[model samples]
Target: MEAAISTLITEFKKYAGKDGSSSTLSKDEFQSLVSSQLSHFVKNASDPGTIDQLMGSLDENNDGELTFTEFWQLIGKVACQQGCFSQ
Candidate 1:
């Protein structure tokens, strides 16, 4: 679990650093991250419109970028859907 958490942080940073911010993910960075890292977990992961919609949903402040916490929401949701935390 600790390793997984560390990997997640590492992965997030890897992509999040693609742009100038190094703190949030722009649409393109998010798309790249999802398509490459989360393809198996998210359907139509590389579709532009799908990524657009997902970005809209995750951009809590409508800033057109996703902070770490916002991105974590998707991870948590996917994990729950996959029954990773089932009792």
Candidate 2:
């Protein structure tokens, strides 16, 4: 579980940059990133429908994009649910 979370953080850094120093991800970018990285964990895996569902759930403002905060919140939630992060 720690390895999985670490892998996610690594991949996110690749796209979003370390500490999100790079440009923020647009909705499409977030979708692609999540699809590729979280494929194994997402219910429909790499399917577009699944990606859309995840975005809908995570994009709090309905802006169709996830800020770093939103992205991290989703990751933390998933990690906790999976027992990767203790409560």
Candidate 3:
């Protein structure tokens, strides 16, 4: 569990760093992260419009980029949907 969480953070940093912003994910960076790393988890992961909608939904501050907190909302939602916390 610890390893999985670590990997999530690492992956977030990796993608977030792609466009010179190690602290947030731009739309293109988010798209790349989702399409490449989360395709199996996200529906329509490769579709640009889908990505656009997701980015908009998760961009809590309407800043056009996703901070780690915003991005974590997605991870938590996906995990819950997958029953990752179910006993």
Candidate 4:
């Protein structure tokens, strides 16, 4: 579990471009990162919509963006679900 968490953090850094030390991301940056890294999962979601829906659902503020915490919460929700990526 530790290794998995570490790998997850590393991947998030790769996407977030902050070495996993920060907890904020511009809305566009977060959307781009998630769409690319999580393509398989997002594509397989039950709704089958693009990453836009995922971002919109989590953006909360409707500012067309997401903070790091929001991004993590979205990813964590998917990761915590069984077979989310398998679709």
Predicted structure with the largest lDDT when compared to the true one: 3
For residues 36-65, write the lDDT of model 2, one tens digit per residue. 776655567567787788778887888766
Q: Give each model's whole-structure lDDT.
A: 0.92, 0.69, 0.93, 0.63
Candidate 4: worst 10 consecutive residues by lDDT?
18-27
User: Per-candidate TM vs. native?
Assistant: 0.93, 0.64, 0.92, 0.57
State the lDDT of candidate 1 residue by residue for 1-87, as single tens digits: 999999999999999999879989999999999999999998999999999988888888999999999999999878987887752
Compute the lDDT of residue 86 as modeled in candidate 2: 71
- Runs off by more than 4 Å, candidate 3: 84-87
Q: In terms of TM-score, how similar is model 2 to the real structure?
A: 0.64
Ranking by TM-score: 1, 3, 2, 4
- Give the C-alpha lDDT of model 2: 0.69
Candidate 1 lDDT for residue 40: 91
Clashing pairs in 1: none
lDDT, candidate 4, at 16: 59
Task: Supply candidate 4's per-residue lDDT for 58.
Answer: 82
| Top of the candidates by TM-score | 1
lDDT of 2 at 74: 69
- Candidate 3: residue 55 Cα off by (Å): 0.8
lDDT of 3 by residue, 1-87 (tens): 999989999999999998968999999999999999999999999999999999999998999999999999999888888886752
* Alpha-carbon RMSD, candidate 4: 5.3
Better of 3 and 4 by TM-score: 3
